[model samples]
Target: MDDSGLVSFFRVESCGLYRIRQKADGEFISDGFPEISKSLFDWLSDRSVLNTIPWDPKEHTRRDKVYCKDVHFDSYTGDYLFVLWFANSEAAGEVGEVGEVGGIDLNSKVGDTNNDSEKIDAKNSTGKELTIGKAMYYWFIPSLKLVASINFKHSKTDIEAFTTYIKKWFDNKNKHPNKT
Candidate 1:
């Protein structure tokens, strides 16, 4: 659906109209438009970005509409690029826009059910302070980037697990050996 569920269509500046429909896996497909062969559909369907959002359908919404920062199709390479991020409802409110990154208020008294000071590692190998509360997932054709953060109040292990699940689908769209 076109963000509203009234109809489904994707239009590109160069490419003409495309009729899209959700597949059984909650991924979308262009129903044989522009006379692309069946093989192309298989390829496109296999690379769906939705596979990276690691929430269980039973626990979360069906995800007909995902929280996305940006989405676009590269005309030069014929690859689709998109960024999906999660800021928890309260964190989203802090940043104003869902697209903003890293305005997580560590001191905010929200979603802070677990406050274990012992688990604080100070920083990860990358030198960035290990944080909790906000997470982001990005997919660009064959590359998938996932970062899960934890604040002082959230469980580092649990957020790590969620990020791991998101990483599991990184190769969902690879045409060759998928990048790790």
Candidate 2:
């Protein structure tokens, strides 16, 4: 959970730049991190569950919900970075808010009322309407007061691919301790 170690790992493993924050002090550990889109940032920051939970450092958290349309960072590429907020243990037992999509919940109200229509209509690369649901994975390392997440399109394939990639990266790192 060392800040430098986390930064180094993400530098090598992430498809895009990752964000890391010191949970205890609200200090950002990521250098030159771009601002998350306003509506998306407000939506996540408003989640009371994220602030109330007593996160266990040993447990990794994953949540699937109808969160938002793809969130674009303030960069030239307009890259989408799924916002993975810290989750509470209680969230697993509770139901999410209902959304436009059937059987999925919007979870929270987006901040910008003017953009509600735009945010609700999530689409895929093919321009087909895709579900707004996303699977977010969060790691809360209390020992280091750090919470880190890397998010992408939600799918079984994407999850497996990320896992496999991380495993291989770790395997290589373990095999060559002094390489970095």
Candidate 3:
């Protein structure tokens, strides 16, 4: 799979300041789900395959590159597929640009997190005990690195789960210099 294929499979939306077509706001996405649309949600609900995406733990070692030796490569969809987050993405206001891009979320604001699937202590059943914040991901494309900076107000566990998944998928494996 290539970059286009990754976007389609992952269904990544547009970059900052713009909303992608048929996107389900974070609220629409179930508690554990990263992001999905109403259609996807319905489909998954029907099949009862909500949490059945097959991905096992993978081990990866860092393969030094000629240009960016220190930068570690993340998950790959195929032999050449790469999910890159650039170092420049760490700079403020960088993701605020326009035009079609991959894996970028900027100026994200929190709306709601009460999707019913999220578990909360009944003592705080008023629901104030539970909340959600803006989750963001960016690819420092120029730097060929992917950076995710998602913050949460009360959904700490969800945030942790997401970050852990990303790190495991990328950090666990190293790119092979000589590909077959």
How much is the lDDT of residue 174 in candidate 2?
Answer: 24
**What lDDT score is found at residue 45 in candidate 3?**
33
lDDT values for all models: 0.30, 0.31, 0.24
User: Which consecutive 10 residues in model 1 have the weakest lDDT in total?
Assistant: 1-10
After best superposition, candidate 1 residue 85: deviation in angstroms? 3.2
Error of 2 at 98 (Å): 17
* Top TM-score model: 1
Residue-level lDDT of model 1, residues 37-92, one tens digit each, is 12222333323332334344446553322222333455564444333334343442
Model 2 residue 162 lDDT score: 38
RMSD of each: 17.7, 16.4, 19.9
Model 2 lDDT per residue over 67-144, tens place: 332233434443334433322223332323333221122333332232222223224142423233234443323223
Better of 2 and 3 by lDDT: 2
For 121-158, candidate 3 gives per-residue lDDT tens digits of 32334323222221222222222223233222311123
Which of candidates 1 and 2 reaches a greater TM-score?
Answer: 1
